[model samples]
Target chain A: MNQQFKDYSQVVSQYIGNLPNDGGDWLVAQRSSAAERFTELGFPHAKLEAWKYTGIEGLLKQGFETLDKSPEFAEHAVLNQFLPEPVAGRLVFVDGVYQADLSTCDAVGITVGNLRSAMAASDRTVLEAIGSLSGVGDHGFAALNLATVHDGAVIRVAAKTSLEQPVELLHMATKSAEGQALRSRHLVMLETGASANLIERYVALDGVAYFNNLVCEISLAQGARLTHQRVQHESPKAYHLSDIHLGLQADARYHGINAAVGAAWSRTVIHNRFLDRGASCELDGIYLAGDGQLTDFHLDVDHAVPHCDSRESFKGILHGAGKAVFDGLIQVREQAQKSQAHLHNANLMLSRQAEIDTKPQLVILADDVQCSHGTTVGQLDPQAVFYLRSRGIDEQLARHLLCLGFASEVIDRFESETLRLQLTEVIRQQVRG
Target chain B: MLTIKNLTANVDSKEILRGVDLDVKAGEVHAIMGPNGSGKSTLAHILSGRDGYEVTGGEILYKGQDLLRLETEERAQQGIFLAMQYPVELPGVNNMTFLRESMNAIRRSRHEAEIDAVSFMKLVREKAASVKFDQKLLKRSVNAGFSGGEKKRNEILQMAMLEPYLAILDETDSGLDIDALRTVADGVNLLRSPERSMIVVTHYQRLLEYIEPDHVHVLAGGRIIRSGGKELALELEAKGYGWLLEEAAA
Candidate 1:
């Protein structure tokens, strides 16, 4: 084998060697499957259309070491310091492994446990659905995550259960003296008529180089309502790759908000499939990039049935020498008549050196569907700046207010008040920095 | 209280206000009536310290200081307020927050205590009601989606809240209905005092009917062609600016 393939195999072997005996079979199978796919796909290059804007050349140059399970790392306060007080059914993960003892999962009529325990339990419904949703054929990191993910979290909501508070999933990565690679997989299923809000947060501890590969799959049954928020605030030395796949049944409502603020190199892929009629989905995102950071988002919303509606809006604020890319697609199948979809992507370039690439697309095979897409990239409005400055606001405060206003439209859509406020604070610190 | 001597300004290399000289003492109201492209708005913008206007000649003095040297915010802190012809809509910025920021900025410049939220809200509510503005407008974003009349009323409400020593109204009655015009004029009239001054710039003399300027000036081709008492506005309104331009050319 070549050096690259050898390195990949060594990482997989390290993760598989550490799996507990109780859940060794499932871990071995998943790791082998993922490794085989990784060997076939290898690292993504500019040749791949989805990875066109974000080439993984630098990530491949330095092969990252797999991180060991460290429950003691949960003692770090960076997660709770930035987040608000924990809501109900809160789960915390340290270095890719779930920390169930420190989490709370009461009053939701749902079960939340570590991925290993859930995989070994009598109910194998969660494991059966893993990798069942297609469309990962071209995504290299997603296939790699499926191949080697050992422990994350599994959450299942029974029928007709309505959660009073949002479930918080905190993923913390603490880098040791030697850099490490962390992979995790999360599964979430809401049965018929179940309603809940889920917030997944990722934070990197200390200032060391690391790589994180994460995959999250959510299944919403008939009449199920779910609001999912993903916040990425890792250290500047970290590289993060995440994929989110969602499937919605009839009359299901799904709302997802992503706030991407930190990391040196980060890429997020979001695939949402509306399988049944009358289902609605909305995705709102905000990304802030500055200095040497590179942030990329690839999103696809599939309307597989008739009368489904979807709206996608993502905004970016780029400063210094940072670069950002947004590729959003809305697809309506031939049989999906009467479908309605809208996609808008806007970016604010705060510095002359900063750059943004936005591509909004619509592909509809149905004759009776309404679809529209738009993209805008520009600097702050000088007239608005003068208007604010004329009112006695200084230049810095005026610019700050304009930037805050730019992000407030997306931030206001957050379902959790605490998360909203916390995200606002994060955006403020980022803009001020 | 304000003086402009030989002020020649250019916007984008095209001269707009050429050798314009004007003076207004305390306790006086001056109305400047001009035709289109006659630099009426340019003068208002220049007096308010807006950018993009190159003052190639002369200087403006306000309260014995060189006003031309100050930035827009500095002029604002010095109690100079301009009611824009078309108020820019600032989405996501609350009206109350904008007002409180302006008020406190001026207060800070004058070494006065800043107004807290309660006091500021109370002051805004009172001033907003005086302009007959709906309370809901205060909660909405600054001028976002406001009707023409509502936008003008919002400008007047801001004027009342700021209570500037020198207030310049730039076509404040352009798009208002009769009721809105009356409310806006009433709001302006209520704020007039012996220690304060105003320069009302408009294309027509209709607004002068309600506010009643003490002096009227006809500005043509970037200069004040004629200055007379309040009756000058009536004569100009009756005969139209075409006759005045003809007379000036003759």
Candidate 2:
């Protein structure tokens, strides 16, 4: 009885029971095994070492119910705010269902479609890459996402092909998802010498008090390059969790940026693994946590090959009673010599109640490896504010400018010019108060 | 343009400016020379509306308005500029954006139409060239990794851009080399006109050689002890503040 401690695992089992019998038989078997894994893992609690700083007790208390049948959604004009038209490729998923009518996918040198279709068609790329890399089992969210995920975007680029325009996948939660759990999975595969850019955005259209669990797995072959950008603007009353796994082969380059500006309680986990030598990864992120918000970013970069480099920098602006956590690990194997990796997390607290729990670790087993991890938790500099104020900038606007300055370093690295300007303005509005 | 009626201030309960009195007319350049430990910087800071100083007594009048009532930025919008001895380094902040935002903030406060990017760029380039400021540096973070001389020159460049009516140079020559000093002085000289007044505070007379002041005052024990013309600075250079201290004591 003591071993059978009750948790959300039973609730998730009930969800798996009601899951629709769709997709290929292989997916049903995969879902069954994932459910088994979830039963074994249960749910993450503060007692676990990795869950020491972030506690999902609030998420558990939400009593989320998974969609029993296909969800119903009414497209609102507000969705247009997230969907900027004229995109090269666009996929919109609402309430765990992909809307083909709302998507304009140009599958010229690539395969871009939703998971259910890819799974029904027995696409080998999607079948092999879905849950292959998120194996650390650090948390139960990945397994839950796998057990119930019905729909998401799948992108596969052929060798020697470079995408001229970026592909965007927007996941929106609608009224039917309110007080319910939504699961989605994405798989991106780049062949040798292939290059493409993708942007994944999670937004709350109408639903509040919903739970969004997502897993995105990206694999790149030799000499491949991919730029992946993620933005989370979930409703302030929603709980969001995501796992982004990256596997890079020889000479592959991966550039990723994660922007989190909403969600009452959110945690983003980024796992990077280098399969061969000469691969490099640059990951940057920024999160704005307002009062009553808890935003956490967890990262793990595994360097198993020589001559690989990785740089991870995440910044946060915490105001009012906001709290944040940044946990990053950079590990270099014994043979992974000449590997250079640096991880930095900087947070600015606007109020005394605002807090941050940051732990950056560098595990170097190779003698010749260059590895570093650092964290900086600071407040608005009074001297800097005085300097700006002396230059005729009011105190309020001075603080706002300084806050924007702290956030722009990462925001500027976002790939698209329009998105960069759009995100900057959004950040400006948030920091203005 | 400015008047100080026996202005006194304290820092942490210790008096730094003890009943200092000064008056400056439009177009006049007043050099406030003092030895170390005097309240030269204190007076400059008070006039610029910097915090951390308690106004123990006395008052300051700028254009007949109670200067103490205005905020730091308000004084700036009202045409008061202080070239700090140590300019605060703001990392991750684009210097060009900082300048333009500051310029527009002051302009908007003064009921002047805001300057657009194109015009601001043109004006800044012209002023930056006049000050010998590297245009490349303007694109970098504000004062981040700037050499000592570059920082001072950047300050003068900002002063030129803001076009302040009353400017205070607080130890502008402290860390400058000869060439840097000349460039800064030249920038300052270009901004000199009948509509503007300046207060140049320095410990050495090196800066005075290039930009001659109409009146020179020796500050000792937190108050102006002596006031004279440009020849007074030459006299002080010939014989350090020892003679002036003795004369003031006598």
Candidate 3:
């Protein structure tokens, strides 16, 4: 069946009948227009310039549909390794539906809860963040998420507050969510003079075939700081797509890390814009793609104001028949003098069958701006391998060490010890395979 | 303890080492000094089991073992160390981690107890201090963005930790100033004993002034044409290699 033929009817119909009508008429009208946009845009294809290397034919052929109700899952015991311990706050979601019984919100200076409730009560933070930054205009995936998302995590920080511990959101899927489409919306708003750490991890059962589409919108007020960590470890047979939008005000700082390690096909698009001068965003990421996997990261940063700096460093380890694409673009506007933007993408192709495409572009329209981009897609340096082997390390272990070296620059940026250790083990296993 | 007889090697079908013969007894420092394009590094690399060189005709005997048959790590496990002319810069692997992993690997092959975190840290610190290397560099990526002198010091530090039976220093004095050369020479001299043998390959007589060599060999056109005592280095330095290259050609 053609993807256009199956259409977004099933998805729109399920959105109209989701849970309850507590989100008020505004949300209803917005969802209706987004549903129409979803129908018009449909699913992103290979012909699209943004998705030339990554084809969604296999995902669209899966024939996904929205779930009638939240699925029952009692496998919390086996998920301890995926969740870091002693976090300040933990919000658990299964198939995009908030599970309050399995969650705990104990952090100070924050009003954190389910997004559906925040939307129902017309929360001011949620109202400004949900669809404002990540609009449904050009991105079809974001539109689909805005039109069909049920329940997700919502975090609002009070001014002049800094949390001591990290806030975590664990999004997992079970067998019941297989063959279904799951959409989640995450909103994070930091008032002036506030700072917090956020971690959003996506996971599913082994070999589960599901579609996880998520949109995350983050807004930072003046002098606000945030550290965001996103880990996508979906099932080997699942399709995952995430759209992350970051808006920074004057003197606000943001640091983000994206670790993509699973899913048959996955893409994470991050959009960063400077709302005022003196803001800085440093984004770092690492990815591992093995046999029959396609992992991609696309980052777009706009330097519209002066005195803003944006830096992106991404690396990937691809083996077997895996394929990965990294596209990063940094644009400095004409009025944005003294803007500093630098992007780097490096990949280690560990196998003969692996493929990696890195495209880093910088467009500077202003004078006296520092802008540069560099990318490298290559196999492990044989000289470096020889250096390790000459030190008495075996060749296999040497290769694994070099591969791990490529990822350490990004992995070491995470503040969570548990998550860092977990990512280390994951990189080890991927190289060993 | 070390012997290379009629060692002939080729790289990319071009002969680099042509019928080179050398021998070093225990506790002896044999300096292989040669002009440019004389394949000084090839001999060191072949002995250390580096790949990419086709040893067309050569037989290396290390403690009476067929050295050419062993893999690179195997050769290293059996206590053969090569202080690379240009130490590789690994971008993200910590220097201390690399040292510890390498030490443990060699130890594991010898069926000895491995060094744990505490002991390894202590050992690396002492060794680094002895080599005049900064302890802070141990926490950084291995040799990444290091100065030339720092790289040479790192090589000596690795040599100190490994305690290899046969140490091949290939042009270890190429990029060091007088102070760094003296420090590195001191480190090399400290490692010298009745049981450890060393082959110091260099192109200058300055390093020979500090670490006195037992035997000096002048190699020209891929073959060693002159072999003499430490005085031979002074003679060659006084007079350029023009006469030696002519003699080798003749």
Candidate 4:
């Protein structure tokens, strides 16, 4: 192996060894295996098709300082700005480590605990699916996250339980020093016949250069329904890489919405696998990038079994000199016959300097499947702008209103009113700025 | 209240309006009757400052100011309103929100205190009822999923709310039934005042029976070929534009 690969493997091994092994033997073993695979494949380059748009050379060259714990920082007002009233549970993490004293989980039938506590409690069900949905070490960051998986939340919804209130997971990053690197791992599982809503927010507290590596896996059993939402609003000095892997069983329903607004350089990967028939999934995403921000989304929907349906739509607005990349793929395996899937991606470039790259792909092996993919990139309709302006709305307000209307198609899909409004404000700020 | 002097405009380098001149005083409704492709819509679009239309020559004056120099919204705030022939659908922006924003914008430019939400809702509901629009339409996106008639009624409802000094109804009667056209005309008539002027542009004379104009002009080949009192619209409907075209050529 090369010297760089050797150094990376050593760091992974050392991090794993330092983890407390109290009843977390299985998790440790999984991490070690994942680490071995990661060591074998250090970092992906331009050669890899999936990593073509996102280059990891900057992350590798800087050699981030490992951040096992968070430093003391003032409470961010934006943190509590849009928190839903009377949430069933709320967990706050700073730089991957949980701050239990500031957390609350008062709702019945829903338990929100730190991953460390759950691991030490030896929850076999949680351990079995820790890194299972993301699969074994296909991506370099997934492997690296599994290796240094120090702290995050373990959200459990009991069987036959239905949560009236949403559960919030806030992952915050505060720089103790420049070049700090934080890694977080979250495992959430919904038992049979359980239904719940989960909102995860990642915000940067400091504007110092840092790297945030996060991985979350979700598993839903038969008749389980989950609404998962992720919002990334990091500082302009931060680099974020997040992965979400979901698994659905028979009759399971999953809805996911991802909003990427912050971070100097960010990439989000969402991989969803439907394991059985009668599974339904709805995925929606919106990314509003302005100024010098670089936002990228790579999503994949795999239909492994027959008689499933999935719908995916993503919209992006690039302003100023910002750049955005979207690569969405819907794959229907041969055995997944009678599957129906549709994928659409649209982008609005406000300034000529703004750039967007979109690729929508569909690989259907089953002749009985119905699948379609489309992408559109253009500026705001001048006719629409003029129409609004003629109604006595100023040019700036007219443009803002037009852009809001453009993004509202996706924002209106949210069932939660509070989250929808919060997202609207975020979108407005991004567009106006 | 409004004056157009030898105005010429082009869209995409193709001339649509060729030296058109007309004038309308307060308390008078001037109807411009023209065949399709006769620069009828282009005139309305240019008056509203829609992009892609280059005003090659001439000028428009509103209340003695250079109207062509003002921005679309600025002209709108100065009491100019254009009821689009085809209203653009805005999905996700609620009717109430759009109206409030427009009302506030005009009010702000006029240095008037903004209306609160309660007052705004009351005004909107009242105007909505005056135009016979369903209250449920206010909850939906602006003109989204609305039928053709409903979209026109929505525009009239907006006119009632904004209460502009000069309202330009651009083919507002095109897709409406008899009842809908009556409601729209009634709404426009109710807002008519000595200080408010109107320009009703339509190709058909059937709408004239509902919203009677004081003066009617025949716009053929990008110019007003003839001008007369309200009876002129009826004469055009009876004789058709072919005779008017022959007269203009002569």
Clash counts per candidate, in order, are 1, 0, 0, 0
Q: Write the per-residue lDDT of candidate 1 for residues B137-222, one digit (tens) a residue.
A: 99888899999989988988888888888999999999888888888999999989999999999988889999999999989999
Query: What's the true lDDT of residue B11 in model 3?
Result: 90
Candidate 3's DockQ is 0.73
- Candidate 4 per-residue lDDT over residues A1-433, each given as its tens digit: 2666677778888888887666565577788888987977778778889888777766677677675555676665435543856688988887666878768898778788988887778877777778778865687777887877777788999988999888989877765636877777888888899999998888766687788888888889999999988788887778899888889999999999888888888999888899888999989988988887889999889998999999999999999999898999899998999999999999989998888878898989988988898999988777777777898898788888878887888888776777678778877776862
What TM-score number comes out for model 2? Answer: 0.96
- Per-residue lDDT of A308 in model 4: 95
Quick one: best TM-score, which candidate?
A: 2
Over 4 Å off, model 1:
A17-25, A69-79, A82-86, A120-123, A134-138, A175-178, B111-113
Give, for candidate 4 chain A, the lowest lDDT window spanning 10 residues: A73-82
Which residue segments of model 3 deviate by more than 4 Å?
A: A1-7, A18-26, A72-79, A82-85, A119-128, A335-338, B239-250
TM-score of predicted structure 1, chain A: 0.94
Give candidate 2's chain B TM-score: 0.98
Give interface RMSD for all predictions: 1.1, 0.7, 0.6, 1.2
| Model 2 alpha-carbon drift over 4 Å, by segment | A1-11, A18-25, A68-79, A82-86, A135-138
Q: Which candidate is the best by DockQ?
A: 2
lDDT of 2 by residue, A266-298 (tens): 999989999999999999999988788999998
Q: What TM-score, to 2 decimals, does candidate 4 have?
A: 0.95
RMSD of 3: 2.5
